[model samples]
Target: MLIGGILRDSSFFCIKMSAYPFFYPMAFPQWKEKLLYWADSRFSYFALTQGNEHSYPQNPFDSCFFAGNKELSENDLWQKRAFKVGVLGYDFKNQIEKLESNNPEFFSLPDLCFFVPELIFKIDSEGIYASSRLSAEFLSEIETQVIPETGSVTCKISPQITRESYLKSVQNIQNEISEGNTYEANFCQAYSGEFETWSPIAAFLRLNQLSRMPFAALFKAKNNWLVSASPERFLKKSGSSLIAQPIKGTIRRGETASQDSENRKKLLASEKERAENLMITDLMRNDLARVSKTGTVRVEELFGIYPFPRVLQMISTVCSELNPDTSLKEIIRATFPMGSMTGAPKISTMKIIEREESFKRGWFSGAFGWIDESGDFDFSVIIRSIIADSEAKKLYFGVGSAITIDASAAQEYEECELKAQAILELLRGN
Candidate 1:
């Protein structure tokens, strides 16, 4: 199966760019390696945390750097695509830097802009700066093979822990809560495997069919990779304006309109949900404040509900006027790690995250999107994603959530499943 011109519109940047080839969530690490090997420069990749085994790494397909007025925009500029549309989002800071070094062609620009999807899905290094032919067919070589219906996975986790062990962690978290250590702490696990023929691109096509999300991405960074069908917005930019949308509250989708309405109302009223949403909003506002003009940051919309196939979410929009003096690189540096994933007191949350979690997040919770010549950039948090490193014969899906005193383990587990639904569908041979 050949999929092309899969452009991703950054709900954050309010700007549109094309997407290149896509993948299952697990292909990221290998893809990143390949991207680094052939490319001539380094770049940035952002990934996001959805909850448990679901996150992505965000990387630029085509990027040009900026140094105060050395703009990337030229009348003839456009996106580039390749045989494999390379994607990278999510973060393992050390891991990302290594990825950039490996893919010399990957770019991390400060104050520059380009179409992320176009670069990954439809454009190429030679055509990256060209004015026309940003179409997917013009860039990538997509191939598909027909295989017999194999509905079951032949493999399973190694040294598998019993349900008792998995259940033990929950009990520990409960213990922590009882001890006043933390109300809810995100936890994760990994399952790796080999695929005689598991194409992430194929998985993505099937996944997209299931979710039909308006915005999605499939990226590969050298050692880690990500494929996502995310419907969440982390941030966006236009001209000199910046905006952020943080998703917090959620309720599963209902079978009927009345049920859905009732669920939405409940999300609106839930104090735990509201508190999580509000805290992230404040964190984002503060993050934006670093690059936005003083006193220009404000909440444009609070507690807005966006319904997805599996669940309902409460998202809030915050906006700020950009600082004329702010450099593009600085803007990103200030907010590379969004507030939604880290929780309030971001640094503290991060330290806790690092200490409590078992593996490095790599690109999850990082931003992915494009930046243009006009100094306009757009990015999305990598949620609802799967990570793949085909060479390692590894496929990993994760889930996580913010914890407060009010969080319920059972409900949080359900939320984790909601986040994992799309990828799981693909895995089930949708």
Candidate 2:
């Protein structure tokens, strides 16, 4: 039998079992070639109940892991029923212009890389299920391997930009907003450091434990690793329906319950924050409209506040229905480098970003997710992430906030610091 152009015997073989404690610890260290583990924290506060919730069927495996595979190019992603997992870099937006830069490259990763896995694990409330093309005896042997104890790692990292420089950049963007050059721009800064001795698996586990974000993921390919605790979903395709959740506003969580309620109220009522979110929401709608069926583009949820462990974010959901014939490349071309990251007036803002940002973003603002055998896919925006090159013993992370006309330079700087807090604590071995 043949399925999706691959022999059925070579396709996934699945087994259902109770959740095992050693699954992550045992698997992480061995699958250094390619591994991706994604978790949806299922936090109580994230109640996204609007827009096609009942109309569209949901994907069964929201939380899953992929291991074992060879790299596939972006061109291969659109093949019929091609099941692959990968990351898309922000530099993919360079197709708009022949942009050139002299900034140093912290992690020399490709713009796009995908892989076909021989093993897959899907986790849900029901339990954990394992699927693989490998022999069952080999998997049984993996189950018997001993789990290693966690190790200590030390890191010293600093922002690549000074406070004065960051504030100056904010003022520059505000000036551009005033001049109608762009409505809003997401300006980012990079932090780079070296670690004495490190365990990539342990570091990711620790980071995931602290953040507990809804879109948490750990992906390793060769010497490059992406440990992400992102709270935003860039895009999801289910059947003919497409969804985008873009986060635009941020405020630190209050210490007390009452203070937290007050902060949420402030974020919801603030004119500036609302404007920032509205601009991006509109941009997303337009982007989807470009590739969607007529009359199917709509804003599902606007300015919905959601809470993570460290902060509260204002996220909006926009959805559309695509033609069955739409290709992955076409959808990405219409909406790559998501709106929340690029700002309003995407092309113009991207040009400004290329000029103003101190370093190349690379995969920082890109997305990571999987494409199923049925061609349905989901991806999360790459924020609140640590990108590392183990061979060089060097690590880098990025933090930024949207800048608008009414934005305060000092407050925006503080916001960036707030966003960087979790990863900073992780690096300090807290």
Model 2 segments beyond 4 Å from truth? 1-61, 96-102, 124-127, 131-140, 147-150
Query: How much lDDT does candidate 1 score?
Result: 0.53
Highest lDDT: give the candidate number.
Answer: 2
In candidate 2, position 152 carries an lDDT of 46
Error (Å) of candidate 2 at residue 428 is 1.0
lDDT of 2 at 193: 88
What alpha-carbon RMSD in Å does predicted model 1 have with respect to the real structure?
Answer: 10.7
lDDT of 2 by residue, 134-218 (tens): 3444444444444445344448988899999998888888888888999999999999988766666666667766777777777
What TM-score against the true fold does each predicted structure earn?
0.66, 0.85
Residue-level lDDT tens digits of model 1 in 224-269: 4566776666667767888888778888888999999999999999
